[model samples]
Target: MVLKLRSDFFHSVLLDEEKCKGCTHCIRRCPVEAIRVKGGKAKIDEELCIDCGECIRTCPNHAKYAQTDSMDDTLQRFKYSIALPAPAFYPQFQPNISVGKLLDGLLKLGFHEVFEVARGAEILAEEIKKYLSLKNIPKPVISSACPAVVRLIEEKFPSLTGTLLPLDTPLGIAARIARMRAMEKGYRSEDIGVFFVTPCPAKVTEVRQSSDDVGRIDGAISISQVYSRIMNMLDELEEQKSLQFSSWKGIGWARSGGEQESLNEGEYVAVDGIHDVMSVFEKIEMGELSGILYCEAQACVGGCIGGVLAVQNPFLSKVNVQQLVKRYPEYHLLDDREGKELVREGVFRRRRPFQARDVLKLDTDYRKALEKYQVIEHILENLPGLDCGACGSPTCRALAEDVVREKAQEIDCPFLLREKMLELSREIFDLASKVPQTMNEERGKQTIESNQDSGTATGESGS
Candidate 1:
């Protein structure tokens, strides 16, 4: 697919120039170089930006923010838009709200249908089980649900591409199933738009990317934007009715360890944060960590509720989600035979043979890398190992990589250049000291021998 930014995908996170201090914190923190300082203010390069929201987390000025869709826009998609609430959505509305009451509030907003992405999560859970049963899968199969993480693999860690589970994310799968159910009910596809009440920009990007042919999920609306509308409606519907739907176990897939815990066994590893996930994935690929049946990876540190665009704090959301899950029926209680069958047929399969870059090319393609390697070796031979980013790169190795990448010259790195200068200065001083004293002593001996020869010649002439 020719990738382009979807206009409907709301970038709730934004760079506020007036507020930005241009610290370049966002620039360094961005897994992609999405944020760059231009004209003394940080700006997002929309083409390059995957909307990971790392900048949103790093900015002390709170300059980066997400753009919110007005309730008016959500309503415009249809005569009545259905709210596809993610399981993470439940925790945002507190003491006054129950998941059932929240569904009623969505109906109050004129949503003709309300489906939980968690129901899709149950289907996904079944699909994941079947995938695990397959032969010769990548070690610690990485979850591709998080768009920010996928984008990181695409850009920074292409080697991990094979490891990403290509299955359509639960939201996408659920949106498709939701739309199909709507069609079966004699609703036109256009008339029944599925809007995701999202907690993060990553989901927005996923909706825009639209990896599967399911062709559901029209747009993603940030939870922060719709919270007030949903909150007000909850107050209005005093005796709100809950929709008869799938078990809460399915909806319980909202948090970090949810997927791994749902599976409950196997050599599973659940990790959050893009950096940490990559580190673990590397070990898995290198065979340092093995025999992993599943890998639950979430981009936001604490998972979706910890998302940069989330209105509620993540720690509190975890507590709320746990309480909500306790009220949920156990997974074994659900009768999702069709979902399990579909998974066995490989209907919801993830694509494979994903890209791994040629890092070896950096050495083979240019002689300069070898030269830089030598310079790095020499620098290490002399300088202290304390890696300070005062040289502009994050570490000494990064400085060396920068030199090879032509991103920075060797002299730009102060520590390496300082060591070279010091070594050169010492050699020059030692050579200067050794040369003069030996030459002066030899000249003095020659002068004495000449005087002795002149005195002998004069005495012989007088005799």
Candidate 2:
């Protein structure tokens, strides 16, 4: 199998240079240290970025944003388009807005059909339970549902890649099922476009740069883009379609710990937020979390509801989801036979193996990398050890790494620059105070002549 590099992937989170103030806000907030302020502008390192949108959330100037597909452009591209709305999309609205009405609103938005990603989540839940039962598989399987979390593992915790559940995400599975259903209705595959109405930039990036299959999803549109249109259409509609198929368990996947709740059994631990996920991963690496069956990790704080592109308050959305959950049944539309058949066909399985990103490596050659590591340590020793972002890098250690990589100079640190300035001033003062040897000899001779004249004058006065 050919392993792909980080450069091969497409990142949806981007920096708007015009809006960026180079205030180091993004650099400080970025979980992976992917952002840096350079030349009075913020720059994202594509290799290091996981498209988690932490920078987007933290940027006070709104300089960071997700680049998603336009609904108009995507609809115009194909003869028929299907909207695959995520589970989190439902909670963005009021509780009075039924799931059926939300589906109807998407149809009014020019989508020929609307597929529920929650249904796909339900399918995945069943399959995951079956996978967990197998004795051959490893314990503590990690959920591959969140693209940002998966990418984080790829970039930061490569050893845990094997622990990731080798399954397609709910959105990916929904796209596949939606496209298949469209084809069954006599629509040509080329004429059909399946788009995910995503709440996060990571999903947009996943849709654009899917390693498993490029054709699974045509595009991803952010929730913020079509939120107003949906709200306006919701009130105008008189009749709602019976489009809701996902169960309460499926709908619960929008919030934190929802994936584990869907299983309803197992030693599962769900962790939300990228930093917290990292902490869990660290514990797993240290063998501190043994005997666990599965780990549900989400990059966003409140799962998908807290996505940077989401318009609703995450806490309010969580409450809305809970209300919606109470109204729906526990079981989803898919029966056990159909779910088993889909699993047998490998619809939920990942086609490509998760590849580790080599962004952490200092150099390609071992010897050179070791030398660079030593140099970075030496440079780090002179640094103030402050993680302040004033130096553009996220931490002093990062600045040292940058210096070793030749991307930055040691004087980039303000403290180091001040010390250098003071040393230069002292050197200049010493040079300026020294007189030339010839000038010193001439002054001495003049002083001696003056002394002799004064003595002769005193002797004449006495005579």
TM-score of each model, paired residue for residue: 0.75, 0.92
Q: Write candidate 1's Cα lDDT for 199-315 as tens digits.
A: 887787666655434455667888877787776666576444347354556655677888876664688888887678778767866777667767787888888888876778888
User: Which regions of candidate 1 fall more than 4 Å away from where they truly are?
Assistant: 1-14, 32-38, 43-50, 211-214, 238-248, 330-337, 340-347, 350-463
Candidate 2's residue-wise lDDT over 275-333, tens digit each? 99999999998887878999999999999999988989999999999998898865745
* Best lDDT among the predictions, by candidate number: 2
Candidate 2: how many backbone clashes? 0
Q: Which parts of model 2 have CA positions greater than 4 angstroms off?
A: 1-7, 211-215, 238-241, 437-463
Q: How far is candidate 1 from the true structure (C-alpha RMSD, Å)?
A: 7.6
**Model 2 local distance difference test score:** 0.86
lDDT agreement of model 1 with the native = 0.69
Clashes of each: 9, 0
What TM-score should be assigned to candidate 2?
0.92
